[model samples]
Target chain A: MGAMDNTPIGGDTRVAALWDGLSRVMDPELDESIVDLGFVTDVSLDAAGRVDVGFRLPTYWCSPNFAFLMVDDIARELARLPFVREVHPKLHDHMASDEVNRGAHLGLSFAETFSAFEVSGTLEDLRETFHRKAFQRRQEAVILGLRRAGWSNAAIVSADLATLDRVVLEDEEAARQKPRYRELLLARALASTPSDRAFVTLEGAPLTEVTLPAHMRALRAVRINMEANGALCRGLLDARYGEAPAPEVPAHEPDHAAHACGGGGKACCGGCARQVSAFQPTAAPDL
Target chain B: MYTTPDGEEVFIIDGHTHFWDGSPENQKNIHGKQFIDCFYGYHSSLSPKDKLWTREQFAKYSADKMYHDLFVDGPDDMAIVQSTYLKDFYKNGFNTIERNHEMAQGQPGRFIVNGAYDPRDGEEALEYIHFLKETYDVKGVKLYTAEWKGESRGWKLTDPNSYRCLELCQKLGITNVHIHKGPTIIPLDKDAFDVHDVDHVATDFQGLNFIIEHCGLPRLDDFCWIAVQETNVYGGLAVALPFIHSRPRYFAEVISELLFWVGEDKLLFGSDYAIWTPRWLVEKFWNFEIPEDIKQEHGVDLTKEAKRKILGLNAARLYNIDVEAQKVRLKNSPLAVAAE
Candidate 1:
C-alpha cells in the first residue's frame, strides 16, 4: 500500500482539471462556456498523457474568428496542465475546420491561419470587442435585478463596487446573478483605474444619476440583442444535432419591470389599444 | 388592399420573397439540403404553431403554393421576389433570376422580380446585369456577399469588382439594391457578413438605395448606428418581422430601437415568404404595440401611421408604386369585389 498508488485516478483527476480550465473559456458571442453549450463532443487521453479534444458548432458556417478563439483557448488551457504533454484541439463539421484545426494545433494566430482572406484586426481585437459587449450584457442583468428588487435608479448609479458587492451577497436574486456578473466586473476592474467606478461604459466613463437612464436604455438593447442571438443559436444547434442541449441555466428571464407596468401583463399602453383595433383582422379578408 | 372598417384602405406589399427549389434532386450536395434546412429551422422555431409546414413541403414548395400564399391565401397586394442563386449548392442554382422571372410571368403586375449578380463573375457579370435589366425590366437586385465561387468562399461590397457592379447598377437604372447581410456562408469569417462595407458603398453610391436585408441582424446595434449616419441606407424587415409572435417583447424592443434610429420612413416590411407567411406576420404586426416602458425609455413611438408605413406605404414609395392609384385599381379588381 504505497502512497504512490494513486495512478488509477490520476488520469481522471487531470482530465477533470482540464475540463475545469475549459469551462472558463466562453463562446465570445454568446458569452457561454463551450462545455455548457454542449460544444465539446469528445475528450481522450493516451498512455503518454497527451490529450485530444474535439468540438463542433451549431452550424457549418459559424464565424471563424470566434471558432479560432475557442479552439485556441482549449489548447492553451490544456497546455497549462503539467501532466499533459501535448494538446490536440480539433474542430469538426465547420466550413473552415481543416485550416482552424491545423492552425490551432500548430499554434498559428487567426491572421496567420487565414492569410488568404483579408483579416482587418488581430484575434485579441476581436476578443476585446466581444468582451465589451459581454460586460454590458452581464451588467444589464444585474441592474435589472436590482431595479426589480426596488432599488432606485439614482441609488444604483451612485453605488460603488463595495456597495454593489454587498447587494449581490445579501439579495437572493442579486446573489444568483453574482456568479456571471461579479466575474465580468472583476475581469474589467483589473484593467481600469483604481479610482474608477465599478460600473462604467466600454470607454471607461463612470455612470452618474443623470447618465444612468440613458446608459440603461442603451445597455437594454445590447442585452436584448445578445439574448435574441443566444436563442437563435440554441434553436439552430437543436435543429442540426437533432437533440437540444439541456440549458445549463434558466433562460435569461425577461425584465420583471416591463411585465409589472400594466394589469393585463401586456406591454401595450392606452394609445396602443385604439391603434390595434384600427387594423384588426376583420379589416382584411379571412384566408 | 386591406380595407379598414372606417373605409380607410392600406396597401400591402411583401417587400422580400423567394421562389426556391430545394428538393434533393436539385441539391449539388448535402449543403443544398442543409441550406434550406437552416431556413426551415428558423421557420419552425418562430412560426405560429398552426402555420408550420412539413419538411417535404419546405424542400420544394410549388409556385402555385407561393402565389396563393402571397396573393390569394395571404394579404399581400404586390410581392417583390428576390433571387438568391447559391450555384455552389444547387445544381440549377437556388432561386435564380430566370426562375423568379418565370414565376412572375404568370402573375404579371402582381410580382416585382429582383435579379442578382455575383461580382466574382467579373466584367461578364456586369454585362449579365444589363441583359437582365433589358430582358426582365428588373428595377431592383439582391446581392449575396457571402456566396461561394470556385476556391473563393465569399466577396465583399468594398472589393473592386463589387464596386464595378454598383457602377453598373447605376448605369442600368437599378435604383433599389437589396443586400443580404445575415448569418452563415462558406467562409467562417465574421467580416463575411459585416455591415461595415455597406457604410462605404452607401456613401459612394448615393443615388442607389441600399436595403440592408434582415436589417443586418445579430448586429442590429451596429446596423442601427451605421444606418443613422447614412441617408441612402434603409432597413429591410424580413427575419425580424416573424419575431412579433414568438418573442413579442423582444420584437417590441427591436422595433422600438429601429424606429429610434432608422425612423419609420426608412423601414420596409418583408415577409421572407415561404420561410414565413405574410398573413400571420402582417396581422401580428398590424396589432403590435410598443410597450409603454420601451417607448418612454427609447423615446420612440409605434403609432398606427408608423404601422401603415412599415406595412406597405414605405415600400410602395421605394418601388415607386403610386399607392393612391394602386388602391383604386385594387378596389375595383375582381379579388376585392369577390371579398366584398
Candidate 2:
C-alpha cells in the first residue's frame, strides 16, 4: 500500500493531509513510519487548521528520548504545512505523556521537558545516532537485494548514487526496494551534499572493496538488531491494541525471484514504483 | 533434571526466574498493570499453547504454582530466584527479595535466592546488602539499573554510588552480579538499560561475575561484542530462550551468535518463570539443533555438551553449584525414587 494511501482517517482531506504528514515521522528505533506501525492512533484537525495528533508507542515505557523525538517531529512536520495554523501533538499511554504533550504544545525542547534528568546532549545527537543506524539498515537492505541480484561487492562499493539508482531501476528486485532506500539515502546524503556518494559511512567515508565486506558485516548486525526490535514492537503493539495489526512493509524482499518476473525497466515495475513514490512528500519537509 | 534417550543426564538450572505479583491489589499504579501486561504479551506470543497462562494467573500466580512450574512439573534441578524490586510500581515492591526467599524456603536447595540493591540508596543500600547477605546469604544480586527511585528514573552501574555497592558486593562475597538489561526502564530519556555501564563495572570489579540478564537483548550484538572482551562477563538466557519455541530461526541466530561471540562456557539458561515455565524451554532447547546454514555461517557447533552447559552448568559454575554432586543426591532423593 502507498504510504499516503493507507490513511485510517477517511473522508476528511484535512485529517488525511495530517495523516500523510505524520506518516513521514518514523519511530527512530524501528525505522518504520508511525502510521504504518499502528502508532498513529488518532489524527484530527479543527476548521481553523489547528491539528491535534494522538499517538502511542508499543509500550508505556518506550524510550522517552525516542518518544519525544517522534512527538516533536510530528508537531514540526504538521506545522510545516501552509494550512496548519497550529499543531498539538498528544502522546497517549506513555509514561511521560503529560510531559510530552505539554512540552510539544508549549514548544519546549526535549532538554527543557525533562530537565530533572541529566541529558548528555541534545535530541539531535540521539536523532543522528538513530539516523546513522537507519541509514545503515536501509543501505544494507539495498545491498542485500543487489547482492541477491548477482552484483559483486566490488560493483556495489564502486557504484555511485546515480549508478546505484540505475542499477535499482534496471533490476526488478532492486526496483521494488528503490523508493524507500533512495529516500533514506537522499536524506542522509543531503545533510552533507546530495552529490556526495550515497553509500558512505555515518562519518561520510566512502566504502572501498576492502571496507565494503567489513562494513556490510557490521551493518548486518545493526539491521538484525533493528529488525528484531521492530518485530518485538509489532508483537507488543498487537497485544496492546488487540486489533488486526497493520501489515508491516517487509523489512527485506527475501524472495527476489518471485518479484523478478515483473519487467526490469522502471515503467514495467509500476506497482512497486507507485508504492515507493507515495513516500516522497511534495513539501520535502526536513525529518 | 532431564535424561535424554542416550541416557545422558542434563542438569537444568533456570538461571533467571521471578515470582512477581502484578495482581491489581499489589499494583501501586498503572505502570504496574502495564509492566505485567507487557510480560503477558511476551508470554502469550512466545510460549507454547499448552504452557501459556491466563493474564490473571500471570499477574499473580501462587507459590504452589511457581513450585509446580519450576520444580515439581518443570525440568529445573535448581532455579535462581532473581529478585526485581520494583518498589516504584508495586505496593510492597514487585518480586522483592523477601518474597523470593519466602517462596524458596519451602523447597530448600531447589533455589538460590538472589537479592537486589539500588545503588541510588548509597550507604543505606550498602548496609542493606550486608543485611541481605546475613539474612538470606544472597550469593548473587539482581541489579535493576533502570529502576525508578523517586524523581530519578534510573541509575547506571558506573555511577559513583554504584561503585560503592559493587565494592560491598566484593567485600560481602556476592560474586554473581546478575544485571537486568531487558526492556523498558523508567525515565526513558536515557538508554536506561545500556550494557555500556556494565562494561565499566565489569572491568573495575574483576572479582565479581556480571551475568547480564536477557543477554542485554535488543542490543545482543553489542552484548556479544562486550562479552568477547570481558572474561568475567556472562550472558543470562532468560528472555532469549523462550524464542526457541516461537521464532526458531531467530532463536538459532541468537544462539549461534552467542555461541560464536560469548561461547558456551559463559552462557546461562533462565526461564524468567511465571512469565514462562521451564518445562518447554528446557525440552525445546534439548531438541533444538543449530541449522546447518547458521552453524556454517557462525562456524560454531551447538553440541549436546554446549546445550548442557547453557542449560545449567555455566550458571552452576558461576554460583558454585556442584552439578555432579547435586545429580548424585537427586538420583537417590525421594523425588527421584517416587518418580521411578
Candidate 3:
C-alpha cells in the first residue's frame, strides 16, 4: 500500500513461522527485544520461506556501526529458527559516510557480510565491485564539488583525490558534531545521566537468572538501583542524554548496560551522546 | 506583444530582483550615493558591458520588451533584489543600488529591493546587511556563488565563513539565499557545489532562509525534492527566461511537487533580474501551470493571482513584507518614504 505499510496481518504464514526468531533480536543498546521496541516495522514472508524484515532506528542517518551490527544480529538469530530458510534484515534507511545512502546496500549487495548463507562467488565479485564502485562515487563527489566551485576537470584532475577525500570527511564531521558546541553539550549531558546503584547490579546479574537458583537477593538489590536511576533519567533529560557513569564497578555507575550501545564493550554503558565522533571534526573555528 | 489587459498596467510586484547602476554621469560633480560607508561589491561572471542597465534605462524598460514575459501575468506589487554576483561586475554594490533605487522606487507597488552580502567579506557582509535593513530599508539579500556555495560548502560553513552570514541573516530574520547552483558554468564533479551540498550547513542553521539559484538544476531532483523534505529550504526562480524558462518551470514544479510530498509552504519567486530576467522574461512565467493544491494552499487563483504571489507576495512574506497592512505606515518612515 503506502511506502511505510509494515504490519504482520492476515494469512502471513512465513512471518508467522519466523516471528518468534525475529522478536528475539534486541537492539544491543536497549536490552529489550527490538520487536518490542517497535524496531521491526515490517515483515514479509515468501512462498519459499524467504523472509525480508525492515526496521528503522530512532533517527534518520543513524550510525552505520550499530546499524550494520543490528542487521547482522537479526540474520544470525533468525538462521536458528526451526522452519526459516532465508532471512534478510533490511534496514531501509541508514547513515553511511561514503556514498549517498548506500552503506548497508553496499554491505548486502556486495560484501554479503550480513547474511548467514555460504558466501557465493557472485557475492565475492560484488564485494570487490563495491570497492571499485566506490572509486567512481569518490570521483563523483570530488568532481561535482569542484565543478560547482568553478574548477574544470583538466584543472582538478592533477589534484589528489586523497585531499578531496579528506575534505569530504572533514567537512561532514564538522557539520555533524556542531564543532562549535558538541564538547560543551557532551559535558552538560554527562553531568545529567549519572547512573544509579541498581542498574550496575542488574547488568552484572548471574547467567543462572535465565533458569537457575543464583543470588536472587543480590540481583534484586541491583533492581532497586535500576529503579532509582530510572527515576533520575526519567526525571531528567540529562540521564538519557548525559554521560552515564561507567559500567564496571564504577565507584561510578554505568547508565543502563542493557542497550547503551557497542557490543560487550564496558565503555558503551556510557550513553549515546558519549559516542566519540567516528570522524572527529578537527577544524577549529576562527574565534 | 501582450498588453496588461485593457492597458490597466497590470498588477505586478517583482518580489525578487537585483540592480548595479554605477554613480550617475549627470551627478558627477555632486556628492553621490557611492560615498556611503556601506558600499557593496560582488564577484560575477557577466562583464561590465552586460551590467550597465541605467536607472533611466531600467525605469523605462518595458518588462514586456524582453522576449520572455509571456508565461505568467504580472503581480499587483513588485519587489527587487541585489545580485550577489554582479555587484563588482558593474560598479560598487551600494553605489549601484542607490541610483537604481532612486529610479526604480518611482512606481508605487512596482519594486522592492534587497541587499547583497558576500560571506567571504566576513563581518562586512553582516555589518552591511544590518545597515541595509535598518538604514536603506533593504527588504532581503542577494547571495551569490561565494555566499552559499562558498562559505557554507567550499570553505565549510563550520568555519564561520558562511555561518556568521547565515547567523546574522537568521538573527536579523532574513531568509533569502539568492544562491547560485548547477553544472558550474565550469567543469568538475566537486560535491561541494552539488545542490545537496547545502544540506550540511542548512541542517545546522535551520531557521536561516534560502532561495536556491538557477532553480537548483545542478541537482533539480534533490533541490525540488528537498523543498518537500526540508520545509526550511525555499527555492528562488528567475533569470533570462527565454533561455531559462526551465528554471521558473522547474521552480514551480518543485514548489508544486513538494507541496504534495513534503507538503510545506516554502516557495519564493526571485527574478535574479536586470542582468537575468528583466520583467519581460519573468512575465512569460506568470502563466506557467501552477498545481491546484499549491494554488489552494496559497489561496490564490490557479493562474494570475498565483503568479502575482510567486512574483512578489511570496518573497515579500518570506522577506517579511506584509502585503496588506504595510500600506498604513507613517509617510516619514524609511520604507514608507520610498515604497512598499
Candidate 4:
C-alpha cells in the first residue's frame, strides 16, 4: 500500500491507515500526494502505537521550506489516525533532515525551525501561492478536458457548478482532476454553491466569454509549469531510489502473518529492518 | 556544427556546461556529495538509457572526456563553460574559473569561459568581478543565486550588494549575465527561484543581457511575463531542453509558449553537460516540432529559421560573434583540423 511495498495488496489495516494518512500530505510545490510521488518509502506501526514514517525527496537539496511543509503535514495527517499515539516523520538524506525532523517533532513553525537562515517570507504565504497554483493547474486540466469533449469556450466559461458536477469527461486527465479541482475550488471559496460559476479566477471573479481565451492561456502557463515540475520530481525520485517496483500491487490471499515485521515476509522484511534502524534512538545522522 | 540531412550545417553555441570535481575526495561535506548526486539524479533521470554514465564517471571525468563530449564527438561548436564556485560545498571550490580556464586553454577559441561571483561577499564580490575580467577577460558571468555562503542560504538580484556587483559587471564590459533561476539547489526561501529579481535586474541593467537559465520553470508564467516586458531578458535551454527526450509533448508546449513570449531570438541552446551531452539534445531538438494544435493556440511556429536562431545564432549575437568569421576561425582550429 505504501511506496516501499513490492506488492499492491496488504492485510494490516493499521499500517495501511498510516500510509493513507501519509498519502494525504503533499509536496506543497507540486501539489501531489507524497505517497503517489514515491516520497514515502516505508511505513510501520509498532505495538506501542508509535508510528515512524520513512521518506526521502527527489534531491537532498530540495527547498527546506517545502521539506518542512511536507514533514509537518505528514505529522498532522498521521495524528488523525485513531490508534496512532505519536507520529515521527523521518526525512532521510535531505540537507535539512535534522532541522525538519526535529522541527516537526517539536511542533515548531518553519520560521522558528530555521530562524538562523532568516527566512524572508512566511510559509503561509508560500503555501497560499502554491494553493493558487494547484487550483489553477487542476482547473486547467478540467477545462482542457471540457475543451476536448467538444465543449465550446462559451459553454465552459458560462457553466455553473451544477453543470460541472454532472459532466462526464472522456479525457482521462480531466476526468481524474475534475473532482480534485472541485474540492480546491470550493475550499478556496472561488465557487460555493450549485448556482456559482464553475470557472472563476483565483480571486473569485467569474470568467467571461471575451476573457476566456486569454484566461485559458494564463491557466495553461500554470498547468505546464506544474506539470514540468511534477515530471522532474518523479524522475528525480526514481533516479534517487532506483525505480520502485511497479506502483501497482497484485491482489492475492490476505496473509495477515506475512504482514508482521520479521515474519519472513518479503514485502515487510526490508521495510521492517529499515523501520528498526530509522527509529533507533541513537541512530547517528548519515552524512 | 550539426549537419542536417540535407547537408546544411547548423552551428551550435551551447550556452551552459560545467567542469566540476564532485568526487568524494573533493567533497567538503555531505552537501557536496548530495549536490553532485542531485545533478546525477537529473542526469540519470532525463538522459536516454544509452546516454547514462556510471556514478564515478559522472562525479569526476577527465578533461579529455569533457572536450570530446562537447566538440570532437558532440555537436557543440562553441561551449560556454560556466564556473560555479561552491567553496562551502567543495574543498577546492566546485568548477571555479581556474579549472574551467585551464581546460579551455587547451581548446582555445572553441570554449567561452564565463565567471561567477558571490555577491554575499560584499565589497569583495565587486573586486572579484574585476579580477574575473582582468584574468579571464570574461564577456559573461553566471550567477547562482541559490548558492549558500556562510550563514546565508541565497541572495536576490535586488539585494543592495548584488546591485553593486552588477554595476561593476556593467563597467567591465561583462555584458551577458546568466542567472540560475531554475529548480532550487539549497534554497531556504522562494526568492531564490523567483524570476521577479530578473525583471528588476534586466530593467536596471539595460546595457547587459540577462539570460534566465531554465527559463525560470515552475515559474514560467512569471518569467514569460517578465521576458515580454523586458527586451534584454533571454532564456537559456539548460534544464528545460532535456524534456525533448523524456517528455517531448511537454517540450512542445513549453517551446511554443517560449516562442510566443520570449521568441526564438531570445532563446539559446544548452546541454548543461555531464548531466546531459549536447549531441543527442541538438539532434533531437533540431528534429522536434511543436504540435500543430499548440502552435495554433500559441500563434507561433518552431520554424527552421527559429531553430537556427535557438541552436546558435541567438547566442552568437549576444556574445557579439560574427558567425561567418567565427565559423572560418573554428574550421581552422587544431581540433577541427584533427577531426578533418
Per-candidate interface DockQ score: 0.23, 0.27, 0.01, 0.31
Write model 1 residue lDDT over A1-287, tens digit each, in one string.
Answer: 24433233365576678777777778887676677666777666665666777788878778877889899989888888887888888888776788998898788888788887655557676677788887877777777778868888777776676676566444443454556776777677632343345567777677888898878777866766665566567556666776632122111235523321121223222111111111111111111
Clash statistics: count for each candidate:
1, 0, 53, 1
The alpha-carbon RMSD values of the candidates against the true structure, listed in the order shown, are 8.3, 6.5, 25.5, 8.4
Report the TM-score of candidate 2, chain B only: 0.96
Task: Estimate, for each residue in B1-340, the C-alpha lDDT of model 3 and write its tens digit.
Answer: 1244435333344544544343353233211232110121110111122333434554223433321221223232445645333332223432244655564554444455566666667777778778876866664566544322321222334446677777777777665655665322211112323456566656777776666665554244456555655556766544312222312222233344334433334545554454444444444554455444435533443355555555556666665666555444312232222111
Report the lDDT tens digits of candidate 2 across residue range B1-340: 7777678778999888888888999999988888888888877766676776788888887777787777777888898998887888899889888888898877766889999998888789999999999998989999888788787777888889999999989988999999888875655566644688878888999999999988888787788889999999999888777766544555676787788789999999888887788887887889888766567866889999899888888888988888878878766653421231
Per-residue alpha-carbon lDDT of candidate 1 for residues B1-340, written as tens digits (9 for 90 to 100): 6555456666899899999998899999878877888888878776776898999999887777887888787889999999999988999988998898887777656889999999889989989899988998889999888787776667788899999999989888898999888776634454544689999999999889999998888778778878999998999999887767755656777888899889999999999988999988887777777777778878899988998998899889888999878767755653422231
Give, for candidate 2 chain A, the lowest lDDT window spanning 10 residues. A266-275
Predictions in order: lDDT:
0.75, 0.75, 0.41, 0.81
Q: How far is candidate 1 from the true structure (C-alpha RMSD, Å)?
A: 8.3
Residue-level lDDT of model 3, residues A1-287, one tens digit each, is: 34323433336454555666766664432223456444566667554555676665533223333455566667777777655566766664332323312433334542344223222233233223223222222223333345446755444433432343333322331233232222322332321232211111112321232322123222222222222222122112221122222222211123322221211234332222222322111222121
List model 4 lDDT by residue over B1-340, tens digit each.
Answer: 8998789999999999999999999999988998889999899888887898999999998788888898878988899999999999999998999999998888878889999998888988888898999988999999998888877888889999999999989988999999898874746866446678888888899899999999998688889999999999999989888877766656777888898889989999999998999999998888887666567878999999999999999999999889899999988875823332
> Which residue pairs collide in model 2, if any?
none
Screening candidate 1 with a backbone cut-off below 3 angstroms (N, C-alpha, C), the clashing residue pairs are A64-B188
Of candidate 4 chain A, the 10-residue stretch with the lowest lDDT total is A272-281
Report the alpha-carbon TM-score of model 3 versus the true structure. 0.39
Worst 10 residues of 4 chain B by lDDT: B331-340
